[model samples]
Target: MPDAENTLLLVDDRPDNLFVLRMVLAEYLPDCRLITANSAEEGLTLAGRQRFDGALIDMQMSRMDGIEMCRRLKQEAGTAIIPVILMTAHHAPADLRARGLEAGADDFIERPIDNVELVARIRTMLRIKHAEDRLRAGNSELERQVAKQTAMFREYWKAVENSRDPFAIIDRGHRYSLVNDAWLKLYAIERTEVLGRPVAEVHGDEYFDAQIRLSLDSCLTGESVQYEQSFSRNGERPQQLQARLMPIAGEGGGIDGVVITLRDVTREREIERMKDEFISIAAHELNTPLAVIQGYAELLRDEPWTAPYKRTQRQEFLSLILEKCARLQKIVDDLLDLSRVDSGWMLVLHKSRWRVRDELDRQVWQFQRETLKHRFEVACDLSCGEVSADRGKIGQVIENLLGNAVKYSPRGGLIRVQAEVEGNVLRVTVADQGIGMTPEQAGRAFEKFYRADTLDTAIGGLGLGLAISRSIIEAHGGWIWLESEVGKGTRAHFTLPLMPAGTEVAIPNEMSDLKIAGEEKP
Candidate 1:
């Protein structure tokens, strides 16, 4: 009579009692299966194995009385909620029937051996069993649906909290229901001050109403609004943020709430402003020097009057113009390199294999020619070993190091360059016996526009050489460093991975020809 078959546990001590009840109950409860136990212990064992829809027990038994057994069954969990019907003899008296009911029995049937009454009671219990089972099944189904929904909401909430950007959900009444940790952190506010309360009550009516009206209008129309805003908090710097507000829909396509996301853009906006300022300063520096050079050169050219006066005056003026031009060119180059590195457009190499000794020899020769008076030395433990690196980039790194060695050192100081293979990397060091830097100066030697203490303070250039050198070396998965004692000397050191012999290193595209032909004549 139910949607599924019901299992019944019948306990009795007498073999005759068990056999008669099984035959009678089998015909009456056709849809139910009967499990008969000879003793109360066996009945409990069966109940432990599987769930039973209902249980029946005889009043009198050899080992345990049915009333005590019923009490124990009710005490045991898993079987505690199952309905029980106690069967007894007609002569058992009204006090005994009251005793059975006191032992957690739902109902009792007197045993008169009346076939009709026994069948009728069994049917009545089966009907009650079906109704109880349906109620339990309904409760369990409802609980399962609730659990599934709760799990889904938990996962969505976790995602919102884990997101890097700020996010929140506001109900139709402009009340905050869900705000992730990032959203709270961004505002530097607490949940208790905002949640379950109208936005106007928490943040003020004017500000809250304006934002809510805009967001709700956009969201309900299935549109999204994105814009930037700035606000000051607790006397700190005004924080800038980019915000996006979108509508969240409920079941049946009705607008439920608005989802707002805010991303911090303060750092990005600051960097952009700094870039514009740098460009303005650089233009002023460049144009002023060029204008001076142009004015002096024109005066010397037009006033070439007396031969001796003209040659001497013109040459001295020409030298000054050339020197300033060289300084201006160096500034322009440094600016270009900075732009390339900052924009992430600089060259990067992968698995470049180079001949360390050959690369160092070429660099030494180039520097020797550039600084004709300065003596350069190259000492290599492994003259023919191969080193893995970007050939052009590493060469530029070496050139910057050696050039700095020549520039900072006295005209005749010793500049020694060396390279050797150590473990899986090739270590290169360029040591110059020149004026060295103090600990404070060495600390910021690789910083942009940084310069160390030198005997001559009139050196011409923005100090981006070492900074660019460090950037290039680090981009190749290597490190560059410098060691110096204030007055002793400075040694620049760097490393590159050593490849197996016979690997070819690719040249970088940033290298260009420095044509002395176009430069002013000496």
Candidate 2:
């Protein structure tokens, strides 16, 4: 936008001199507004109320000389910056002009002030005023923008600092620009040692085993890099950490820096370890039944007509062979389920709201028919309202828990199953009066391929059922925990939120990562 209309203040006591000045300005500079102040009192009063672009005054006046008027204008801060030009008729000696300047006149003019010279001098003063005003305005705007940018940057870094993930930012020169608290904690590095230093120089041997320096250098070339590393400290298990570094772009779309982020993946690695153990144990367990089935089939085929293989005896042998084959198939099916759970391939139908009591009753009836040794009983709410959960997953959990209760109670004992409403939750507990576990064994019982060494030594299992059950229960936004004492009994309790039948629940991240890790396992 064009500058505000140029305004000038003219002060002179002589009415005749003022008239000449006003007439000259009006004729030569028609667009300029000349505000005439007949006396210093009038000029000072006018200046106090309004902002003028410039001022012009005569050197001689009554009551207040023009030099005195200029001095007064320069004294007060409000008017100090208004450019003052003095009109001097007595200019024979250079002292007069010097004295006028000393009194704060920007420039002195000799009378009879030439009409053109007077106009030219006034225009010069006006131009200087306009330039200074523009410079001041530009500086004020710049300061405001700087403050706004600073506030935005502060908020951005605050969010980075609060994140649980370790994160860092490096500048175009590869010097560290930002490092969050998590980053500092993960690396055990101090803030003083990192900021504004070259990333390579600062992290020279910190990640000695991994190619972290190379990864950072690759980011400067606009590459996104991710890899895993293990950090071991003082005899404790090494923590597996995954690091990813990506290029940060500048305003011109150039790679200016890098963003480095890392997250702990130790549990992920442990789960993978369990998966490997499952494959090895499954193969070994499946071989036992297969060998029995194969050896008997060969005997029946080779000695069909022998006297020792009488029809009745052959029939008995064939029956035993069929049982072994069935056992083999069952083992294969269970292993397949373990695989499905690990890879998240099992699609559990969350159908109509079904009563927990109905599910428990079915399991109880099956157990009653299957075995006469262990007694299975349910103590749950018969009319418990519907829950929003995957019915199949819940049933699977119950079946696994009940099966464990029976398997551990080899001497025949009572197994109690329960489900009830507690405030906004549906709580379930399964207790077995069996040879239980030590504290250390119970703590790891839910881990895949984990079992109590003593009790499970002669038992037939790959130890994946409890882990799979735990995974399913947790997927429904519920929790599962167990308490056991050596030679006593063990009770496992779980809780699910009580809500409307079809409430949506988000599956945990471990479940998703579990699937990916399982599929990638050997």
Candidate 3:
């Protein structure tokens, strides 16, 4: 019995001959379907109509001989691949056998045929036919898979080409195989200048050897590597870049190339540094006042009750403790306000109609008494009228500006406060003869936790003052900005919209007003 089902064609002129052939095939190859025809003409007709895995035909036919039928089957494209066998008499001439061989007959069977020999020849032909069939099917499937993978590669390449991050593919020889548009733009090179060029030639040999070669080698060894590299382009500021290299596997299951992607992390790295500096400064700022309050409280607690001048000493210790507590409270409040601004919930302003000149005069007079190192002067125009704004918030902004002026101007320089009415706005300026900032520093002066002073500077304050002041002024529909030059001076300017002369507006309740310590209410 055969392992697989197959159809076999048997042809002979005599009915008894056809019967004997069918019985022999049915008994030996039980799994195969046997079809019999009485003549060579009938066999050819049946072969044209249906498929057969193997064919057996008697040589001595009256009209069409077995050799002629085999020749006809081989001549047609459809049946050319089917295996054919010819059965001959035991005493047949050698020319008859030679004729069958020339006609594409696969094997010859002699009669009286031995049943074992007939079965063996038929099995061999079937095995060859099945092998050819499998080979054709395998070729078709391989072609289909190749087409599918080609399409996928095209899609992936398109995505890489259009991506914002720089991407490139480097072959095992360290020559560029492919580079996307962003990669070309980043290096300021054309496509013709990069493709097929050695990586060392593009990025100088020194840079390649020092920074990129080690990572590329590691990636080619099937390891993914990532590192930071800083380089300037077109004489601009140095850009911090994060580069990642990953191995690309070849068809033979080994690393064939490396895929490199670079991301610009200059701004991200700057923010990280600023955050770390802010944390250290905030810790120190909070600790100093806390230590002062703790020491004064402990001194007052352990002091003898019967000591001379105990009453006056106790009052002085209490005053110092209160001052430190106030300082700590201001720090906490400023931190909370900055947090609120960052979280998108800005400060709540209690708007009221207040004279801009009066607020400026009051803040200027207060600063004059507090600081002896700097002289204070005010010039307010009579035309400066009332403005609809938050009084306490406005005062806090003024105090922050004045305090910065006094801190930065350490050599008893003049600090002038000026205000005037321009159109519908009241413009105020606080200028000081101070150790000022560079243009770059002034640009970022309003950013949260950003300070013009370096860590080594003796000046102390949380950098949140200017940032919070901007938020307060902007919330009131006003604008704030700073102008400064290194070692010369700084001028802080802010503008508030002036209320119309006869216009009346509702003022928030006194309980809802923002209260500041030592700030008088109007």
Candidate 4:
């Protein structure tokens, strides 16, 4: 006997029929087990006792036919997958094969089974069973993978919705497939309306659409793009927003869509603008005072004798030259202070207690002598005796306001300086009946180097006064604002705290350098 243990069953009612088939099978498969039973019930009972690799059942059995036995085996879940071959005599009805197949028979062998044909049929059915086993295992694995991926995607979507930053994913066709709460809120769009909608169409405006379209195309090509976009819609204040588009990978490692992120960066933009203005100041604004000093110095140095000027005239020329030099020095100091102030750092303060009145009086007296056109008034109720501040910086702020009052009141009207203690804060206001400012001008007045249009272009000062003033005040824990009417005048008001309760202020050194007396007059 050849060595093998694969079991095969044969069922037949006649002894000679079972013997003949057993001899033929043994010749071809000497090592395999071929069990034979005389009745359908006996074959079914054998099947219940052990597993069989294959079964060939005679179609016509005395008590139970091959179809009935095949049907019963197929109905049970445990044996339904076993391969069954129906064997029939030539006298069996022509339709017996078809009837056997319908009852779950896998194949048929004509009566007086050919050893060669029977062998071929048995091998074919075994191969089919093997293939079906592999297919069922593969299907199970595929289903598991699908369920795992579904769970991951559900968790990812929840995170996207809950995030604070604006997030969205658009497909290769640039349609919104996912959007976070921040995205919907920032765009003012409804979820039902935005999903599946084209991105450019939703943005609507030409400029924003153009920006987004370009980035979308780049992201689809697998490039990450980051940029700043300025937005101003309706009467809203202009905003600077930073945006990023990152490529999302898909099937076959190809770019599928983009995950977009946007955030507000207006304050950063302002700092950038100030840096640019600083460069402008160094490159160009320095020339104005240089030109003045050069002209007057040359006049006093070379042409004084030829002009036969009076004694007072010669002194005046020198004074003008000194003033211009001081103005140039002040420009340098203001730039340095601003660079420090705008940086996200401490505003290096030397706070000291002093009477607000004395500071304003000195600034007003100096302005009275400097300008002959504008009449200035000072009303200080020292009811708020001492305030804590960088005296030199505060003096510079007051000087700037008084200077602007005289400079823009080109028509020379009353410039009023008033200081009074309001609760814990002492309020100081400088009002000028000069050519004031438009609403837009006043709004940006405190920005670096922003000059109002109403002021004469010939006025000789860089536009750093209000910006520097605001930075100084805020650094000292105060705020400054300006109220202006187009043709009427501007009232620039600022407040400082009287020394905090129980804290003594150091006696401030009158560091009368450029931060104080030499600030650009508006």
Q: How many backbone overlaps does candidate 2 show?
A: 0
Q: Report the alpha-carbon TM-score of model 4 versus the true structure.
A: 0.58
Q: Which segments of candidate 2 are over 4 A away from where they belong?
A: 1-5, 27-31, 41-51, 58-81, 88-117, 170-177, 196-210, 220-224, 234-237, 247-258, 265-398, 408-428, 432-480, 484-489, 494-522
Query: In candidate 1, which residue pairs clash?
Result: 352-389
- What lDDT score belongs to each candidate, Candidate 1 first? 0.76, 0.78, 0.85, 0.78
Residue lDDT tens for model 3, 1-522 = 354579988988889998988888779888888889988888888988999998998888888999999999899988887899899999889998999999999999889999998888989989988898788789889889889898898999899999999999999999999999999999899999999999999888998999899999999999999999997888999999999999999988999999999999998998898899999999999999899999988887777668744678879988999989999999999998777766666346677878888898899888888888888889988887677888898899999999899988988789999998777788889999999888777878887767777557658988888887877776665678887887888998888776543333332221122222123311
Stretches of candidate 4 exceeding 4 Å from the true structure: 1-166, 200-218, 225-243, 263-274, 300-314, 343-354, 386-390, 438-443, 449-460, 500-522
Error of 1 at 48 (Å): 4.1
* Candidate number of the best TM-score: 3
Off by over 4 Å in 1: 2-4, 14-20, 45-51, 91-94, 113-117, 134-152, 209-212, 220-223, 232-240, 251-253, 265-471, 475-522
- Evaluated with lDDT, which candidate comes out highest? 3
Would you list the clashing residue pairs of candidate 2?
Answer: none
Q: For candidate 4, write residues 1-522 as lDDT tens digits.
A: 122646788898989988988898788878878889889999889888888777888888877888999999898877787899998887677677778878999988887667899887887787787678678789989999989999998898888778777898899888998899988887687999889988767886585466788888888998999998886667688878899999999899999889898888987776776666556556666887789889988877786555677889889988888887897888888777766655644455666778777788788888888778888888888486777777887898898888788888898989999988787777888999988887767877776656554233546566778877777776565657888887899899887766653332322222111222123221
Please give the ranking of all candidate structures by lDDT, highest first, separated by commas.
3, 4, 2, 1
List the candidates' TM-scores in order.
0.57, 0.62, 0.65, 0.58
Which model, 3 or 4, shows the larger lDDT?
3
Q: What's the true lDDT of residue 51 in model 3?
A: 91
Q: What digit string (tens of lDDT, one per residue) describes model 2 on residues 1-522?
A: 122388889899888988998998899888887799989889889998898888888877789888888888889999988998887775537776777788788987788889999888878888888888889899889899989899988898888889888998887777888899998887688999999988668767665325666777788888899998887666776888898888999878889888988888888887787677667677878888788888888888788454567788788888988888877876766667666666656445464577888888898888778788988878878546677777877887888888888888888889899888887788888899988887667777876676565243556777877777767776676677777877788888777776666554544435432211113311
